[model samples]
Target: MGKIIISTNVSLDGVVQDPDGQEGFRLGGWFGQFGGKDLEAWAKISLEEAMGTEALLLGRRSDEWFAERWQSRSGEWADRLNSLPKYVVSSNLEQPRWSNSTPLTGDVVNEVSKLKQELDGDIVVYASYQLGRTLIEHDLVDELRLVVFPVVLGAGERLFGETSDKKPLRLVHARTIGDGLAFLTYQPVRDA
Candidate 1:
């Protein structure tokens, strides 16, 4: 089976919203707000990861947002993203604007589980907070790659909100980016 990976940018306090200041959250944009050589290196690594992903999983909001933006862009990364098959988890979105996009049309957990069994490549989920929470609750996430920034936002969307259970994670890899950001990779430990 293919792995379902969540790649998210979070703050020291676990906030994961509007890190780029494009989401209208005035208190956000903490990512490049304090820039350094390390930030550049971190960005490069993130881009590399995104490029390597074969398939993309996104929530309805993220799907619409990225579809509107990335579809119109002209670049190597944009080209790859546009060409990759995108699986969007949505209850309300009937049709997606992007090419090669499909909506998860059944029960969220069951449908995603079936998708996992059918897919043959890496499935990367990016910035889909609600879907991420649901996947985490359902024990569907295989790996979590979190790029933790040093800033601590007092209030915002968090990586882990109200969870159904205490999900145990084992740190498999960790590294500090050039700008003091910590790149942490974790895998969920199977319960005995």
Candidate 2:
């Protein structure tokens, strides 16, 4: 069975809003402030994660957002992302426009559960706040990978907004990717 993993870019204050400042957030583009070794290391890490994943699990909005932006770019990262199979959690999205994209049917949790059992590798979710909350609340996420930027956005939508359960996570990996970005990996301690 494939593990459901959530990979998110967050701020020091737990804000996961518009990191590129493209979504009209006041604190948008916070991620662009870094360069040099930090940027290189971060990019490499992200690409590595994508390369390791079997498929991309994303919300409808996130899927569309990624498809639009990546379709025009040409590189190792873009190729990996665009070529991967994408499972989008959207009831209304019939006939996904992106390549190798499929809209999940039935309840989100049920569909995800089935996907986990059917797949053989990691099913990675990227930058889907609402979907992340649903997964977290349902105890569906197995590994949580966070690239925490070193900035505190005082006011913004947090990643974990009042979950239904107390999830205890075991730290699996921690590293400073670049200068200010801290890459932290944690596995949720599920009750056996």
Candidate 3:
């Protein structure tokens, strides 16, 4: 079965808001504020993840955001991302702007479960915080790969929100990216 992996970037304070500063958030653009070896290391890791991803799953806004930014880029990473099959979760999205994208209009849980059964590798979710919460609540997410930047954005959208119940995660790996970044890999602990 395909594993649904959430690969995202967040601030030290767990904020996942506009890292690019395009969303008008006061603390936006925390992603590249400090450019150095750490930023390069982060980009390298992100590229590796993209190379390994079998497909991409995103929410409507995230889909739009990525499409607008990546559609014109030309490189190995951009090529891989553009070529991968994309599934956008939206009931009202008439057409997806990204190449090789399909809109999932049915129930979120059911549709994602079906997607999981249909593929055999990593289906990475990038920058889709709302959809990430729903998947976590439904126990549909298999792994979470979080690259945490060094800044702390006290007030912004966080990677996690209130769920119906506590979701326990088992840490599989933890390391430092470059000098200031923390790379964490976690797996959802399922009850036996």
Candidate 4:
């Protein structure tokens, strides 16, 4: 069975919005605000994750967002992302803009559960907060790979959203990347 992993960069305050500043959020572009060795280290880690990801799961807006920015780019990371199987969760998305993309229009939980059984490796979710929340609530997310930057964006969309009940997590890994970034990995604690 495949593992569903929620992988994304976040701020110290848990803000995951407008990391690239393209969304015009006041705190946008936080992802590129830092520099030097720390930035390089973060990039390296992200690249490694992308290279190893078996597939990409995204929401409709996220799919559009990523395609707009990455479709024209060419490099190792870009190539890997572009070629990976992308599953976009949407009820009304007529066509996916990214390459090798498919739209999942049925129940999110059922579709994702099916994906988990079909694939054999990591099905990484990137910057799809709404979908992430649903997967998490359904207990479908196996791991969370979060690279936490040093800044605290006081106001922005957070990595987590409302759920019917609290989802407990177990920290599986934690480490710093260079001087300013922290990589934290967590897994949901399944009830015995």
Best by TM-score: 3
Q: Write the per-residue lDDT of candidate 1 for residues 58-165, one digit (tens) a residue.
A: 898888778778888877777888898989988777897777899987788998898889987779998898899999999999999998888878899998878876
Q: Write the per-residue lDDT of candidate 4 for residues 42-102, one digit (tens) a residue.
A: 7788899999999999999999999999999999999999999999999898799888999
Residue-wise C-alpha lDDT for candidate 3, range 1-192, written one tens digit per residue = 999999999888888999899999988888889435688778788899989899999999999999999999999989999999999999899799888999999999999999999999999999999999999999999999998888877899898999998899999999999888889999999983
Q: Which candidate is the best by lDDT?
A: 3
For each candidate, give its TM-score against the true structure.
0.93, 0.95, 0.97, 0.95
lDDT of 2 by residue, 8-44 (tens): 9888888888877889988778777643358788898
Model 3 bad stretches (over 4 Å): none
Q: To one decimal, what is the Cα RMSD in angstroms of model 3 from the true structure?
A: 1.0
Give the poorly placed runs of model 2, Cα more than 4 Å off: 34-37
> Clash totals for all models, in order?
2, 4, 0, 1
Q: Point out the worst 10-residue segment of candidate 4 by lDDT.
A: 34-43
Residue-level error in angstroms, candidate 1, position 141: 0.4
Worst lDDT run of 10 residues, candidate 3, spans 34-43
- Candidate 4 backbone overlaps, count: 1
**Higher TM-score: candidate 3 or 4?**
3
